[model samples]
Target: MKKITLSLSMLALILSIGMNEASAQKIKINTKGIGAAEKGLKAATFSDADAAKLAGEAVAWMDANNPVAGPNDPYTKRLNKIFGKHKNEGGLALNYKVYKVKDINAFACADGSVRVFSSLMDIMSDEELLGIIGHEIGHVANKDSRDAVRSAYKREALMDAASSQSGVVNTLTESQLGKFANALLDSKYNRKQESEADDYSYTFMKSHNYKVTALASAFQKFADMEKASGDNRTKTEKMMSSHPESAVRAAKILEKAKKDGLAAL
Candidate 1:
């Protein structure tokens, strides 16, 4: 009886230690490198509730400070309608808004918020716009923005900058947030990440029955713009800086479109 009791106590202690170890192990995300993993883990550390709260605050700041104009513009209405059409396709409650900025760029935040720029609309057709929107949506669905925020927090440049003096995790004013946004926009994503987002966008648009060729065409247009406007600062910068070279991006999209049997828009 004494031997049996001792055996049972040992077994219980071992089980307790195993459970504690399991609980203490950090959840690792399947990202590329240590840096990427760190970013992903930081983003994943936020509960769904906390992510939603932060997203809401960020959008509110954008809405109040950078109120998008041309709300009544036909193009604006059309863009909004298209976003509404496929908002729920990814099993997330997605919201869309346009920014009045002239820079030809668009981005999505975590919690399914998409922001499109007005200048991009001036250049892209409706179908092309869909492609851009789809790409931005992919980022949101993939939680790239959250990971990006985490990466920013880890960087000394971002941390020590005046804009980040308040800390990247804290609530920021519109101006402060704008500075952060600009920095992010200027940053180039790794080739692998860009490829993944491209894949996501292609799959998403095809699943939704959109003309995937529009993505290719959109890239072609940007490439042309880059070539034509050599010295013009606004045009060249808009066409060049914020994205990968249009030719490269377009070629990737074309290959995917061929595999997916994408028809022209």
Candidate 2:
């Protein structure tokens, strides 16, 4: 318990170093109707501001509820090392953490919060991890995260935004906050969104002169893990279930790499 508390304190310190008041101002949670969006009633559209607010709330809730790997953890230190080597030029001052969970997953929010599972870091190479992080950043750059949030929240978002316009405060309940976290974490993108993000990742790697095969290799690792788990694959590969099939995505990555001359026959 002491170790966990110490880790959390150190993690908070690192996070505070990476964050600034200006960044926090970008996602002001005090706005009216920002988080009070009701559940269900589809119409996937939301302003950037709305997405930022929800993302901030979702990340905050996730951080509080999850057992995050602290700064002193070997996995967390390694992940920070890998994450720091990248250039996040897609309009977000990204901050990342490794959650101390066995789930193999990583996600990025519109608010530039990226949470990666320690299990994922343990399994992936540094280059492979960068490819995955690039993919997550691609989602943020393409505004897919915002659209997913809006769609999952439905008309409630519009209503709340409207209420916000009228200066009516709309705060979320504890239940609503949990729902938002789940929605953000488990949101599924369509084939198009997934493919587009894949392409963005490819370009991101190529631009950095990183090995393009890292992306394909990462996907192949997931595919192998899936097959190895058999019936228990669902629990092991929870992050891949909502995504494009790993084998298919891997093939696409190879195809793109070859087409760009990053891979040879």
Q: Choose the strongest candidate by TM-score.
A: 2
Off by over 4 Å in 1: 1-44, 47-52, 156-188, 231-243, 263-265
lDDT of 2 by residue, 48-78 (tens): 7677777777667557655777888888788
TM-score of 2: 0.74
Residues 45-89, candidate 1: write the lDDT tens digits. 545544454445545555555636577876569787777677775
Model 1 residue 159 lDDT score: 38
Error of 1 at 171 (Å): 10
Q: List the residue pairs that clash in candidate 1.
A: none
